[model samples]
Structure formats: structure tokens, C-alpha cells
Target chain A: MGTIVSILVLVLFLTAILTGGYNKKFLQRVQGSNMWDWLTTVDHKKIGIMYLGAGGFFFLIGGLEALLIRVQLFYPNNDFIVGDTFNQLLTMHGTTMIFFVAMPLLIGFMNVAVPLQIGARDVAFPFLNALSFWLFLGGGIMLNLGWLFGGAADAGWTSYVPIASNQFSPGPGVDYYVLGLQISGIGTLIGGINFLVTIINMRAPGMTFLRLPLFTWTTFVTSALILFAFPPLTVGLLLIMFDRIFGSHFFDAAMGGNSLIWQHLFWIFGHPEVYIVILPAFGIISEVISTFSKKRLFGYNSMVFATILIGFLGFMVWAHHMFTVGMGPVANAIFAVATMSIAVPTGIKIFNWLFTMWGGRLQFTTAMKFAVGFIPTFVMGGVTGVMLASPPADYQYHDSYFVVAHFHYVLIGGTVFGVLAGVYYWWPRMFGHKLNERLGNVHFWLFFIGFHLTFLIQHWLGLYGMPRRVFTYQAADGLTWINQVSTVGAVMMGVATLVFLYNVVYSRKSATAASAERDPWDGRTLEWAIPCPTPEYNFAQLPKVRGLDAWWMEKMAGNKELEPAEPLQPIHMPSSSYRPILMSLGFFVSGLGFIFRTIEVGVLGLVMVFLLMFTRSFEQDHGYHIEVDQIKEAEKGA
Target chain B: MKANAEQTKNQTAVQTSQESAWKHVTSFAVMIVLTAIAFAAVATNLVPSHLLVPLLLTLAAVQVVVQLYTFMHLNQKGSGFPVAFMASGIFIGVISAVALMILV
Candidate 1:
């Protein structure tokens, strides 16, 4: 199977190269674009849009993988997908969703919204930001390339050591997973640092910490979480890479090494990683609910505190995931308590949302509906989360359908729903058009119903002693009906996503004139203060923030708009360049090289990557800037 | 306000040279103490191989704090956010590591 996949992947690559060479127009587009333009482009909005488009593409691919799994499980003892194929599908689905889907979508939101909320023109390190996005895209491509090859990664997304070890699973698939994620993880880390610096240093004058919008605040904390959470992952991946490529004994239990070390390293980055994925969604829900309800976010201080507390506790309870590993009752009990403690802060956030909606004028926009829907869905996910926190209870649930149901609810019901809400909420700012509300509602209902139908029953199945990750099951297990229902739900989700795609395309032609207008929601944040389809550099002159809800404060003071922080000054904007893309390409080539190092072509590929790196580093150029007068004139025209 | 400004300037100058010298001295002292303790543990066999790793890790933790305060100037003003972020990362790293050690 693996050999066949590899052959197919090679064929696809050859086909792409041939097609590129054959088409003059395509080659021109690829080669004619100035290399420097793409390498250094620092426009936050553009970077954000790129992230969204890339992330959306990956989401579709991951969702398709999910559909495949559902189809396989549709009937008892089904052979729609063989065992190895089933394993690969599950692995790719989990990996794609977490790494390719959730992470990029959150980063996309950050790239688009962070600078705007803070009244900054761009992130502090725009060049690095562009580089991060490219690296991420490269990683995503590498992970998915397994499809063309004989198979995708068959190790579960977590890729536990003994199973992922070279001796047990001798394949290039896991190598692709490790290298792809390592490259992308570097991008995520850089992005985290960029946002941390931007938020801390570049806030508009008088936009004090407390005065910042909730979304910006969450972005700030989330960046902090990323800074802290990603390094361990980097360390773990490096060890794995060394073990796989250089024959290191770090995770080889037979050697003087411990496999547990990898788990520690991975989960250290993993637990807070949940917050890294969810906090931004929490921020989005905060903004959406408040805007639609026409109220100040309830218990603003508590919400802020809860976010911080969750982030803090996120690091503490990672061990709960390890309870069944037999750390003994004392360790288990300690981890269990630590895990349960997270629920307090998470519960606080839920109530805060409900209170924000209480007694306020509620407009049921598509964005708001998702936000409202998130409460119950996430609560169910959360309840299962608490249940799983108990060590003894977890022994029964470990690696069962229950565990699968728990995370899907949290990730899909929590993070995916939040991302969808953000897209609806910011669609106008991003594309100068609203997603068709009618279609959006259809998308939401189908998705919500389908989501519950699929995973909600899995919990019962788990409780009834069904193991997860099984490619097939017998009719006698009584799992057949529930599996059929789950497949139906998966189909519904597929239809909903199709409707969403159509809505996006359809709205391009016939969106209301009102939809084209920026600040359609009479929004409180600084982002809505700018014109729709925000300018490339973002702000002409940074807005002076006076108090909480900076825009709202100005409105209340009868100023009608923000006062400028300074007279217009020329903004030193980074020019777009292709260095980042090229650098990532080098890694992609090197990955292929590592996977097939026995071949002479692989050696040549590795050498080429080294040469590319040296060439790229030596050829750096000072970025270009736009004059203040040009920005002023542009703003005036708007 | 003027007097405060003058005093602040004097303090800054004194602190700059003093802190620089102190930083060098403290780092040297820390290195010696850390080496001595490590050697002593090895000599006495007080640090078992299993505990040796954890002990070295603890030492590294101490060194990190020292580095942050002295080398990174995290204890000083204008260092708040970066320090906070670093601390948070370390906290998360430690928790995840400990969890993985027990769980896996």
C-alpha cells in the first residue's frame, strides 16, 4: 500500500511539473512575479486573507477525510475502506484538523483582526509574519502529499512513540508528519512572537491593557500561550526527527531512553495547545455575542481573568490525559483535580456569554446564532471533559469512542463553530460583502444538527464498550444503527459546507450594498473604524484610544471618530518578497530527500536545499516603505 | 519633578555600572556553586541516575531564572510583557513535561 502511494505521489509531482512547463501562462505567473515582492509583503490584511484561503482549503481536505471515515462506519462489517486506509484517514483527519485547519484559521483571524483592534498598521515583525504563513503552507502541502503517495500517515495524530517507532512502522508517512509539523510549528512560534510584540508595544496611544477589546486581549494571551506552548513541541519533534533520521535513542525504550519522554514533551506543548486553539474562538464568541446583543461584554474583568486562568491551568492538567498510563493513584488523583480545576474558569466564560445576552436586544444574525449555539454544544463537550478528568473513570473511557466524542464536540462544536462565527462576523471587512444570511442559516443548522448527530451517539457507544479507531465492526455489537446515524450526520455536514461555499461565491455577485459597507455592526472595536476591505498598510494615522471600547468611547464623547495619535508620518512598510516561499520550498525538498535518502536523487535534493538556504540568507534586501502623504491622500479618497 | 528627574538620572548611571559588575560576579558564583553541587552529588552517589536527570533539570531551571533576571534583565523595568510571556511558557512547559513523565 505504501509503495503504491509513493509511486502515485511521484507521478502527481511529475504531472504538476510537466503542466507547469507546458503552459506558458502558468509558468509566467509562477516565475514572473518578483521574488522580493512575495518574500517581504507585510500587509497584515493580505497575510490574513492568505491564511484564511489556505486554511479553508485544508479544512475541506480534512473534512473529506472525515466523510471517508463516516462512510466506512456507515454499515456493520463494512469494507468501504480497508484497515490501512482507515488508519491513514483517521490520522490525516486529526492531523489536518489540528495543525492545518484550527491553527491556521486562528492565525488568520489574528492576522486580520489583531492590528486593527490595536490601531496598529501592521504586526511588529511583518517580514517574519509572511515567512511564518509560507512555512505553514509548506507544511500543510507536505502533510497532504501523502495522498498522492501510497498512503497518508497511519499513526494516529498523536503518533504515540512505540507505534510511530521506525522498527514497528517502517514507512515515510510518519517522517512526513514529523517534518511537516516541525516546519509549520516554527511558523506558529514566529507568529506568536510577532503578535506578542505587536500587542505589547504597538497599542494605540491610551489603549491601556484594560481598555483593549476582548478579542485583542485574547489574541494577546493566546500569543503568550503559543510562545510558551510551542517550544516543547519543537523539542519533541527534533527528538523524533533525530530518532527517525539520525538514529537517536531518545524514544527507543530498548535503548537507554524512555518513550514517555516524548509524551511529556508533546503534551507539555499539547495541553496549553488546546487553549492555544480555543481561546481565540472564545474571543470571537465574546465579540459576536456582545455586538449582536447590543451590550457591553458582561463581567469583562472576570472574562479576562477566566481566559488567563484557563491558560494557566491548561499547563497544569496535561497529566490527566496520561492518567491511564499508570502513574499511580496519587499522581492520578493530583492530575484529576488539576484537570477539574480548568472547568471552573471555562464555566465562568460560559456564564459570562449567557449574561452578555441577557436583557439585551438580540439580533439573530448568522454569526450570533453560532455564538448562541456554541453555549449548549460546548457545554456538552465540557461536561464530557469533566467526566474524563476523573482518573478511574478515564481508565474505562481511554481510547474509546467516548474520548473521540469528547474532543470532536470540543474542537468542532467549540473551535470550529467559533471560527465559522468569526468568518460571518468579519466577512464584510475581509471581502466587502456579507455571506448570504439565508444560506448561512442553512449552513449553521445543518452543521449543528449533523455535528451532534455524529458525535453525540459516539459517547453512548463508547460507554457501551465500543473501542475507537477500529476499521470494521461486527453486526452483533449493536453498533450498526448508531454508526448509520453518524454517517447521515456526516453527510449533512458535507452538504452544509457545500452550501457555505456556494454562499461565499454567490454573495460575490449579489450582496446588499449595506453588506459592502464597513462597520455594518456599529462595532465597538477599532477594526470597524476603518473602511471596508481595509487598506494594505491598515491605518493612515494610528487612532488615539481614550478609554475602554475605544471606538465606543469616542462615539459617546460625540467625537464621531477617533482622534489621530500623531500627524501622519510615512509608514515604513515591508515590501513583499518570495524568500519565505523559497525557504519553505527548500524544506519541502529536503523532506522528500529524507524520505527517500537511499536514492541518489534524494541526496541531490538535500544538497539543493542547503544551497537554496545559503543563497536566500545572503541575498536579503532592505524593505520598501510608503510615504505618509500617499496614505493621507488615499484615506481622503475613501 | 525636576529634582526627581535629576535623582533618577544619577540612579540610572550608578545602577548601570553597579549592576553590570554585579551581574558578572553573580553568574560566576552561580556557575561555581552549580558545578560544586553536581560534583558533590556524583562523588557521594546521592544523585541516582534516574534522579540525576531530574536534579540536572532542576539545576537548569535555576540557571534559567538566573539568566532571565541577570542576562535578560527581566527583573528590570520595561521587561514586563516579555518576562510574563517567558514565565508563562516555562510554566506550561514544566506542567506538560511532568504530566508526560507520569502519564506515558
Candidate 2:
């Protein structure tokens, strides 16, 4: 199956090379840009938008894989997908969600909003930021490349050893998964460092740690989590890569190495990984809710503390996922309690949101609706989470439909919903035009209902002893009706997504040019201080931040504008270059070589990749500066 | 001009003196102790293999800490967050590896 996909991919590549229209045009345009320009493009807004567009594209692909899973599971004993095929769908769905959807979306939001919130022009490491994005794109492409070869990875997204062992599952599919994640994980680590440095060193003068916007604060902590969380994963993947490629015994049970090490390594990174995905969403919701409510976020310090506490606790509870694997009662009990304790900080965040909205004149825009909707949906998932935290109870629920329902509720309802809300909240900021409200409402309702219908009943199915990851179940199991209903919900989600796409495309063409100007929503944050379609260099001079909701503070003080921190100066901006893309391509080629070491073509490709990297490093170009005169002129026009 | 040149020469000499003194004393003392311990363990065989692994690991851990503080400058200014992040990562990695070792 994987081989067939590879053949198809080869065909597509050949076709793309032959047709040479859009793809060729894009390549030409990319080439026309100076090699150094892309390398140093220090514009935060551009990087942020690149993250959004790239992340959004991956989200669609992941979502489609999810829909395929739902379709296959819609009927009892259905053979719509075979066992290997089903495995691929499940694997791709999980991998895509973690590496593609969740990571990219969070990074996208961080890239887009972090600089604006902190009153900075760009991230601390602009070149590294660009590099991270390209590496991420390369990783994403490699992960999906399974479809073109023969099939996608058949091992679960976790790709537990013994199952993932070459003897049991002999293919390059798992290699793609490992290498894809390894490359993307590097991007994530780099991004985390960039944000950390940005927040620490580049905040506007007087915007101290305590004065930071919640979104920026969360970005800080999330970046910290990423810094701490990703190394174990890198170590684990390297070990696994060794085990597969070089015949190491890291996870070989027969060779006195333990398979459980992979689980520990994966989840050590994996558990904090959940917060790495959700905290940013939580940050987004905090901003959206407060802005729409017209209130200072209640218990702001507590909210900050809660974010920190959750991040700290995220590392402690990785073993809770291993309860059913039997690490003895003491270990299980410890992990169980630690896992449940996370709810306290998470609960504090929920109440803070509710209280912020208690008496304010609440505007129910699509973003707000999703924010409000997140409360109950996330609560349901959270409750199931507590239930699963009990070690003995988990014995029955582990690897069942209940586990699936629980996570989908949390991930989809919490993270995906938060991302959608962020998209609606920031749409005007990002693209200079609003997403059509009516269509947005339609998208939300359908998605909300569909999400509930699809996963809600699965809890009962699990209770009735339905195992997960099974391609089919007998009709006698009494899951047929619920499964059928779930299929309907899946279709509804599909319809909603289509409507969303339509809205995006339609609004782009229809919205008037002037409507693209900044602050269409009377926004409170620093991002709205700049003009719509923000400049490449965000501010001519940095704004002196006086208080929370800095822009709003300016308005209330009757200043009607921010005070500039300095005289207009020549803005030093990084130039964009193709080195990042080329560097990532090197890794992609090397990965192919590593996966198929016997092939001469693969070996040659590896050599070429190394040569490319060496050449890229040697090719140096310094960035140019945008003079003060140009900035002043642009400001005058605004 | 002669005085300034003399001062520059003195500064370089002093810097190199400090570096060499620290490097020689630390390496000789540490390497001797580590070699002695390794030989002692092999010769005596007092500790069992299971215990041996842990003991060696502990020694390695101590060595790592010392190296980080002295060589890596982890104890210096501006090293707080990076140290914290690296330590937490290593701690989590150890815990997870141990858990999986026992469980799976």
C-alpha cells in the first residue's frame, strides 16, 4: 500500500514538473527574490502570516484524514477501509493533529500576535524563525508523502515499539513518521527559543513582565514548556531512529532494552505537549473574551499564576497515560492525583472567563460564541479526564472508545474550537477584511453540533466494551445506530468546513478595499494601534506602553493615540532568503537516504543534501535598512 | 606608550595564568579520582552489577553537575532560565525513561 502511494507521489511530482504552470510560476517568483532576502526577513507580521497560512493548510489536510476515520467507523463491520488502510488513517490523523495542526496553529498565533502584543517589530531571532517555518513545512510534507508512495504509516501515531519494530512492520512509512517529527521538532524548539528571547528582551520599554498581555504571557510560558518538553522527544526519536536504522537495542525488549522507554520519552514530551497546544488557545480566548466583554480580566494575576502552574504540572502527569500498563499501585496513585491536580488551575481559568463575562455588555460575535461554547465543551472533556485519571477506573477505559471520546472532546472542543475562535477574532487583523459573520455563525453551529454528535455517544460505546482502533465491529455489539448517527455528524462537520472555505474565498473578493484598515472591531490590544494591513516594520517608533490594553488606555486618557518612544530612525529589517527552504530540503533528501540506505539514488541524494547545506552556510548576505524618511512618509499616508 | 604596552602584556599573562592553573588542577585531580574509583570497582567487585550501574550513574551525575557549574558556567549570571529549562528537561527525561523501563 505504501509503495503504491509512493508511486503515485512520484507520478504527481513528475506531472507537476511537466505541467509547470502555477507550480513553475511560484518557483520562479521564489527564485527571483534575492537569496539573502528570505534568509533575513525580520518582519514579524510577515512571518506570523506565513505561519498562519502554512498551519491552516495543514489543518485542512489533517481534518480530511479525521473525516475519513469517521466515515470508516460509521457502520458496523464496514469494509470501506481495510485494516492497513484504517491504520494509516488513524496514524496520519494523530500525527497530523500533534505535529501539524496543534503545533502549527499555536506557532502561527504566537508568530502573528506576540510581537504586536509586546510592541516589538520582530521576534528576537528572525532568521531562526524563518528557518523553523521552512523546517516545519518540510517535515509536514514528508509526513504526508506516505500517500504518494504506497500508504501512510500503519503503526499508531504513538508508534509503540515492537509494533514499530522493523521485523513486525517492515516499511519506510514509520521512518517518514520518525524523521518528519524529528525535523519539525527542531522547528518547534527553535520557535520556542525565539519567543522566549523576544518576550524576555524585546518588550516595549515599561512593559514589564507583570504588565504583559495574557496572550503574550501564555506565549512566554508555552515557549518555556516547549523548551523543556521537546528535548526528550528529540532524544527518544534519535534513539528510535538508531534502533531502526543502526540496530540499536534502546527499545528492543529481547536485547534487554525496554519498549516502555519510548512511551515515557514520548509522553514526557507528549504530556506537556498537550499544554503546549492548549495554553496558547487559552491565551487567545482570554484576549477575545476580555475584549468583547469590555472588562479588565478578573483575577489577572491568578490567571497568570494558573498558566504557570498548569505548565509546571504538565510535566508531572505523563505517567497517568501509562496507568493501564501497570507500574504498580503506588506509581499509579501518584500519577493519578498529580493528573487530577491539573484540573484546579484549568478550572481557575474557566471561572475567570465566566466571571469576566458576568456583567459586561457581551457581544456574541462568532469569536465570542466559540469562546462561550468552549466552556461547556471543555468541561465535559475535563470531567471525563478526571474519571480517566483514576488508575483502577482507567483499566476498563484505556484503549477503549471512551479514551477516544475523551481526547477528541478535549482536543477538538478545546484546541480546535479555540483556534477557530482565534481565526475569527484575528481575521480582520490578519487579512484586512472580516470573515462574513452569517457564514461564520453557520460554520460554528454546524461544527459545534457535529463535534458533539460524533464523540459524545462514544463514551457509552466504550462503557459497553467497544475497543478502539478496530477496523470493524460485529453488528451484535449494538453500536450500529450510534455509529450511523456519528457518521451524520461527521458529514455535518464536512459541510461546516466547506462553508468556512467559501466564506474566506468569497470575502476576499467582495470586501471593499477601505474596510481592510486596522481596528475594524474597536479592539483594545496593542495590535490595533497600527494601521490595517500592518507595515512590514510594524511601528515607525515603538509605543510606550502605559497600561494593560495599551491602546484602550491611550483612548481613555484622551490622547487618542500612542506616544512614540523615539524619533523615527532607520529601521533595521532582516532580508528574506531561500536558505531555510533549501536547508530543509537537505534534511528531506537525507531522510530518504536514511530510510532506503540500500538504494544508490538515496545515497547520492544524501551527499547532495550535505553539499547543499555546506554551500548555503558559505553564501552570506547582510540585510538592508529601511530609512527613517520612508517610515515617516508611510506614517503620514496612514 | 611603553607603560601601556607593559600593562597589556601583564593582563594577557594574568588571564592565561588563571586559566591554566584552574584547568591543570581540576583535570588532574578529577581524572585521578575517577580512574581510582573505576579500578577499585573492577578489582573489588564489592557492588553487584545492578548496584554498579546506579553507582556509576550517580558519579556521572555528580561529574555532570560539576562540569556544568565550572565549565559550562551554569552558575553564572544570565544562565538561570536556560539552566532551569535544561535541568527540567533532563529531569523529565530521566523520570519518563525510568517509568517506561519499569512498566513496558
Candidate 3:
């Protein structure tokens, strides 16, 4: 099977190169036309859209998984799904939503917004950006590949050890978990490094850290969190891979391997990983709230400090997740206190957002609705979080539906809502089209209601002593009504998601009026100062930043556009390459080989990967320059 | 190049190459001396077994410093992020390893 697959992959790849993907003339023609352009695109905009598309596709899969889980639990002693299938649905739902859906969608927004906000033509390492996407996608595909086999990971998304060990949960299921995440985690780490370099080294002449758009600021901090957080996960996953495939004893207790090592390493990465996913949302909320309110962000410096403080505190509070693991009173107390203190920074952000919208003339756009709606819901989540932080209370909440409620509040209310708000807010900038506001509001209301209905009941159910990750309960437990209600709410959310899908489709069908509005929403950031569907070379002439809200400053100064910081020069843009895709495919193939313990396949795959890297090093393709005349031609209408 | 009648375009190139050669020789001498002392300590059993572990670890740590500074040029100007990232990796590794050790 493996050989056949490899041979087919090689054939298809060679055919693509021979046909058009690599031929210089064919590449140029197809570059302006079809699938080859997307496959080999180094354009941050196209990559961002691809991330969005992939995230949305995964969201549907995860949502279906959620629906299946909820349906099984809708009634007492439900047989909607069996024990094994329930576990698969549960594990895949959590894993897919967190890793595949939220991270990529949020990264998508960053890819589109960060470069424009920083006034750069593209990311500093455009090639690495492409590599990041391919790697992430490759990892995602490998992870989902488990479904095509007999089973998928069933040890929960956390994949707690001893239970998840090969002796307990045999087969390729857990193998998929380790290798899939390891490959993807590498992609995410390099992406983090890429953004860190881009933000620090490629900002426009005057776009200092303080002057940067809030979303860009959050991307920077999130990338830093990724840098520090992902390594432990990589180490942990490699250990598990060794334990599973190579007959090593990394997490095996009979061999004197301590399981706490996995927990500590996982949560150390896990805690920061949540912040990694959420901080970008925080940045998005700041942008949306301030934009709709027609005000500069309240307490820009305070907001920046708050964001950094949250990132810093994110590292110290991983032990909170391990309170039930008998970490001792001193450790628990230290972690509990550290966890609660995080609220101070978070609260500062909350109030600053509120103050930004307090007295201004606010627009009640759909994005604004989500932003306004996020405040109270997130605070509710935060309130519950503080409750959970107390170790004593957490003992009761651990593995309970209440814990589920608390996190859904943070993840969904914070990240998902922020993603929707960003999508709605930037859709015009992203695709040069507007999603119908009335339809958007309908989608928002249903989702918001569904979110509250589902999670709100869960808090009570958890308090009533119901455990989580269980498929069903007895009717006599008196939990039937709430469970049913929770299921109903989840269905509503699914319906709400359908409404959003409709809005996107409808908006695209009638895109005649949506052409490139340079300053839609009267945006206050530098991104808005540029043309919509942003030019390939983002800023023809970089804008000089004079203040925090530079674009707003220019608008107030009665200038129709930003004053040019430099005379237009030929933009030195990086050429697209198929190497990243080839390299990632190598990782995917090798990962599959390891899972099945096929040494020859693994060797060949790795050799192919390294050879591609060697070829890339030797090939000196100095990317073509966009001429000043071409820039003038493109900017003619503007 | 060493011919008496030959002229070099840049005079400083000769001096700079000679200076680098001396530094390399000095570094090599220091490394050899350190290794010899470490070998003598372990082979002669002058250090107790438990104490030997610490002694070797100390020597190995010193050797790593020499390797990085002399061979890797970590002291150079462009090595900031690499140094920071490496230090962070070490810090996290130590924390994890210690936490697990204490827990068990």
C-alpha cells in the first residue's frame, strides 16, 4: 500500500512539473490563470485565503463531529453512537476544532492583515511563510488520514499517558496523533519565527512597536509564545512516537518512565497554546471595537502591556491544569495565584475595549455586534476561570462539564467570535466584497444564542456532578433535560453556521458593488490606508507613520491619502516556488512510513526531503523585480 | 605568497590571517590541555566515582563554551537570536527535567 501510494505521488508530481508547475514559460502562463498559481503561491494574501478555506473546511468536519457527540448525549442512555465511535467523535472534535480550525483561521487573519498593517510588501521570509502553510496543511491531512484507516485517536485530545500508551491503546491511532502533531508543530514554529522576524525587522520606516496596529502587535506576541511553547510539545510528541513506534520507554511506567513528564510538557505547551490562539483574537477585537466606535484604541500602551503580561503569565499557569494530579499544596497554591493574577491583565484589556466604545459614535455593523457580544460572554468565561483557578474548586471541576463550559467560553467566545468578527470586518479587504449585514446579524444572533444556551446549561450540569468526555448517562440521573437542551443549542449553532455559509456564498454572487473600497469601515489602521484586495506589493510607496492611528491622523489632516515616505522604486518581490510543497509532502510521506514501521519507505521519503532542500540551496533564483512603470500602471485607477 | 619579492594588495590581510592562525593554535592548545587533565582525573581514579561525575560535567561544560566561542563564533554580532533561542531551549529543558525528577 505504501509503495503504491509513493509511486502514485511521484508520478503525479513529475507529471505536474513536466506539464506546467515548473516549466518557466508554463509557470508564467498558469501563474496568472489557474491551480498552479495557488499551489506555488508565495503571496501572503493567497496563502491567507487558503488558510481560511482550509480552516473553514475543517470547521465543518469538527462541527459534524460535535453534532455527533451531542446527538449521542441528547438523551439518557443514548445509543446514537457506540462507545468506540463516541470516543473517536469526542477526540476528533476537540483535536480538530483546536488544532485544525481555530489556529489556522486565526493565522489566516494574521497572514492577510499583519504584512499590510506593517506596510511591508510581503513577509520578510515569504518562502518560509509558504513552507509554514504547506507544512501545516500536510500535517492536518496526515492527522485526518487516521479516519481512512480502521480508527482515529480515541484517547481524547489531551492523549493522557498510561491510557494513551501503546500497551493500552494499540494500533496506528496514537501513532497518527504523535507524528501528525509533530509535523504540524514544526510548521507552526517556523511560522512563529517567520512572523517574529517580519515584525521586528520589516516594519515600515516609522512603524515602531508602539505605532504598530494592534492586530500586528498581537501576532508578534503570539508568535513569541509559539516560539517558546512549541518546543516542549515537539519533545513530548517525539517521546510518544519513540514509545509507540521505536520500542522506546519514554512514557512507559514499567520501564521507570514517569508520566508526569508528559503532563508537564504537554500543558507547558498547552497553556501557552491557548494564549497563542486567543491573543490574536484579542488583537482583532481591539481593531474591530475601535474601528466601529470611530475612536483610537483606548490606552494603546496599556493594551500593549496587558497583551505582553498575558503572554508572560501564560507560561507560569500550566500547573493549574495539573491540580488534580497531586502536585502538592505549595505548587497548587503558587499556580492558582499565578492563574488568578492573569485576570488583572485580561481585565485591563476588557475595560479598555469598553472604554474605546463608551462615548464614541458607534457603528452597529455585524462585526461590531460580534465584538460587543464578545465582551460579556468572555467575562463570564473569565469569571468561571477565576473560580477554577482555586485548586480546591478545581478538584470538583476537573473532568467535569463545568470545566468544559469555562473553556468553550474562552475559546469560542474569545477566539471563534473574534475570527467571525475579523472575517466580517476584513472580508471587503480580503476579497473586495461585503457580506450582507442583515444576514450577518442573523448568523451572529443565532450563534450567540446557541453558544449561551449550550454552555450555560453545561455549567449547571457540571455543578450537578456530571463528568465530561462520557457518551451518556442514565435517565434516573435527573440530567436528561439539560443534556437535551445542550444538544438543541448545539444544533442551533450548526444552523447558525449554515447561515454564515449562505451569507458568504450570497455575497460572492453579487460582488459587482464590492470592488476595492480603499477605506471601508473608515478603518483607523495603516492597512486601510492602502487599496483593497491589497496590491501585490502592499504599499507602492511606504507611508510615513506620524502617530498611533496613522491613517486616522492623515484623514484628519485632510489628506485623501497617506504622504509617501519614499519615492516609488521597483519592488523586490520573491518568486513563488514548488519546493515548500515538495518538502512538506516529504514530511507527510515519511510520517506515514514511521507510523507503519516501514524503514525503507521512511528512508526514501527523508532522502527525497533532503534532496529537495539541497536543490533549493543550489538554485539561485533571484526573484524578478516589479518595475516602477508597472507599479504606476497598477496604481493608475487609484 | 610568502616570496620576498611578492607584494600583497592589502597589507592588513597578511597581519589578519597571521593573527587568526595564532588564535586557532592557542585555542587548540587549551582544548588539548583540558582534555588531558580530564583524562588523568578519570583514568587514575583520583576523583571518587560520584565526584567524578561532577568533574566530568564541569569539564564538558567548559569544553562546550570553548567549542561555541571558538568554533561556532557565537560571540559574533549576528548571533543574538540564535543565542537567545538556544538559551531559552535550555531553560525550558532544565525546568521540565527538574520538575519531572522532583515529582517522581
DockQ values per model:
0.49, 0.53, 0.41
Any residue pairs clashing in model 3, and if so which?
Answer: none
Q: Tens digit of lDDT per residue, candidate 2, span B1-104?
A: 99999999999989977996787579558856875786687689988978887787777777777677766768778998778777877876677666666666
What TM value does model 2 have?
Answer: 0.90
True contacts kept of 3: 0.55
lDDT of 1 by residue, B1-104 (tens): 99999999999999987979977788969967987887787788877788986787677778777877887678888887677667665665565655555455
TM-score of model number 1, chain B: 0.65
True contacts kept of each: 0.82, 0.82, 0.55
A162-184: candidate 3 lDDT, tens digit per residue: 77888878867777778788888
What TM-score against the true fold does each predicted structure earn?
A: 0.89, 0.90, 0.93
Candidate 2 wrong stretches, greater than 4 Å: A1-42, A598-620, B1-62, B100-104
Tens digits of per-residue lDDT, candidate 1, A54-151, equal: 99999999999999999988888888997787989999999999999999998999999989999997899887898899889988998887777645
lDDT of model 1, residue A203 = 91
Report the C-alpha lDDT of model 3 over B1-104, residue by residue, as the tens digit.
Answer: 56533555356668876887888788888888889889999889988888987888788778878877777778778888678767766676677677767754
Which candidate, 1 or 3, has the higher DockQ? 1
TM-score of chain A, every prediction, order shown: 0.92, 0.93, 0.97
lDDT (C-alpha, whole model) for all candidates: 0.84, 0.83, 0.88
